[model samples]
Target: MAFLVVSRYSPLFAILFVASLAGLHCESPGKSPAFSFRFERFEKNRSLDAVIALYGDAEISDFVVGITRPAVFSSGRVVYRKPVRFLGRNPSFSTYFAFSVSSPDGGEGLAFFLAPSSSPVKESTNGLHFGLPPGATAVKFETRTEPETGSHIRVEVGGEISKQSSNLSNVSLVLHGGEKVHSWVDYDGDSKRFEVRLSKSSDSRPLSPLVSYPIDLSRVLQREEKLVGISSSSGNSTQTSSVYSWSFAVKRGAPYSMHSEPLDPRPFVVRARESPPIHLRRTYPWGVFVAMVFAAACGGLLTFFVMFVWFALIARRPVAPVEYPVHPVEVGYQQIELVAGEKGVDSTKK
Candidate 1:
């Protein structure tokens, strides 16, 4: 690792040297760019474990030492469902997602990384460095308002930037939370070349690779087990972004088509969402149902009140006794006895 760096930046200088040692080919950044499938193409189960932060909260919601806000020392990560397939010969893997960032002065920026899985996602002391985990390879996307520096891309391998190989130039595109920009990272197993592309639209890939490096994965990856995901950070500078969608895959058959595009980009068509980050759809119905129940309860109370008032009014009046007429065809026995007593012993004689 120490001997790989012998000089200053030159076109494909570091890449050539590195690839030679590893026995791989890295394409130049100026070459024709193409490749990668959209994330929407995958099913829901593709996710292994996700540790990204949403709404200023982290994927691990119950933790005390996790990131909870933007523009702070924060980073987010999403581990693939399984170790990316590698034959230990030549391997190809890709991750694509659209991100939007907003910062006033300068933000530390976002990073794409691969690291070992621990009990919990590691948090860096500073956001500018993306709380870089040990043995991690990361590519950072800095915003124009980074507190310490201007906007640019910085690549870190093994927790340190290879000054001789890293690019420290400003990108022309303006990034914010409103408008999303598409980014693609593709590692060609055939060439052992890694390339990245960024664009404003998913209908098209970037015209050319933003940065290209020749890395032989079979050498760097010790075991077949590893993690692939993204992270971002900000110190004093405030920033915002979202991982709206993402996808990853391992090849077993043929080399992927160098030129393949989706028939329908569907920029206007909103696909049936599998789920939303924060769901209010169900809450809407619950609210309506609760209100209806409350209304019915009030109506019942009103009816009871009206009936009570009617009873009070009725109580103020006196109720008259009802009389029944009776026929005296058969004289009351008491009356007959009274007559007999009046007439003396007449009843006894009868």
Candidate 2:
């Protein structure tokens, strides 16, 4: 009886075996164009800026990108357009952003990154811990471990002095894959502080910051310009995640709006803000040996602009209103009888 049953179902078992082998054949990560990863702007539906995506092994039938597109069986990355003032020579600056990441059954996890624009993305690697490629600085949220998946912050420059710290309290880094998590990364150069925070509400104050990092913006920002983005990777189990929305803003007076800073729209500048005031480094002529003399002459374009602005802001006194005097009018008809003496004399003489 058992032999008869085995022989009857032999074809079904063979078909299932063939399908499993095919999945393994296409399971190569970071390679193969047929299973290639996608990085692109998410323009339709809910107004998000970008995305990185991949489908399950041999599961590429209906891959979607924008809001309406299902984020099923996808693993991808996305970055913002513009670069803000990360660091500088003299004056320092700070920036803050708000973003949301959603993953139902966490795979590799999400990452927030600040990468130099010059580096190309093709050379990057993928995994839960190393969400970003090698050429950038990143803070990754790892959700694939046993006890408690950890979130880490890291910076790597020219493959030297690379370090990552998970010293943050796990409570602060709490996240769930299916539900949306609201996160914020703040880099305040003025305070010399770097921190990450998450919240349930958009308007809520940062809940005990997940982690705090003390970074010297000047050193971390090797390049003057950098891009803000996110990345994630999954295991063979197959996973998908999406960046719901992202807003990049530089702190101005009274906090700026989401669009306060846009990825540099110009291809060449790439998220660069307005250029800084010009600096003239040329030396003085032989006739003027003193440094002050050279500095006075160096006030070419920038110095003039500063002076113009100063004068323009000065308030001018209001002019006095003009006054016109008003006079009374009198009208009367003169009688001709009183003036007849001269006229009568002329008539009588005639």
Best of the candidates, TM-score:
1
* Residue-level lDDT for 277 in candidate 2: 16
Q: Give the per-residue lDDT digits (tens) of candidate 2, residues 1-350.
A: 34454466556545645654564444222221111111122233222222222222111222222211223333445554445454234223223333333444545555666677765543435333334645667766555544542544444444443445453344454443444455555555555556555554323544445556565555666455666566665543345544544444443111212224332212211132343111112233543444344345444434544554454444233457899998999997654433357546433221
Which candidate wins on lDDT? 1
Runs in model 1 lying further than 4 Å from the true structure: 1-56, 59-68, 118-128, 144-150, 162-171, 176-178, 222-224, 252-270, 274-350
Question: Which parts of model 2 have CA positions greater than 4 angstroms off?
Answer: 1-42, 45-75, 82-87, 90-106, 122-131, 148-174, 201-203, 222-224, 251-350
Per-residue error for 30 in candidate 1, Å, reads: 29
For model 1, state the Cα shift of residue 253 in Å.
7.9
Find the number of clashing residue pairs for candidate 1.
9
lDDT of 2: 0.43
TM-score of 1: 0.53
Candidate 1 per-residue lDDT, tens place, 46-130, comes to 2412322322233432111122255455555444433443543665666666665665545555667766654244454455555
Q: Which ten residues in a row are the worst by lDDT in model 1?
A: 28-37
Q: How many Å off is the CA of 281 in candidate 1?
A: 29
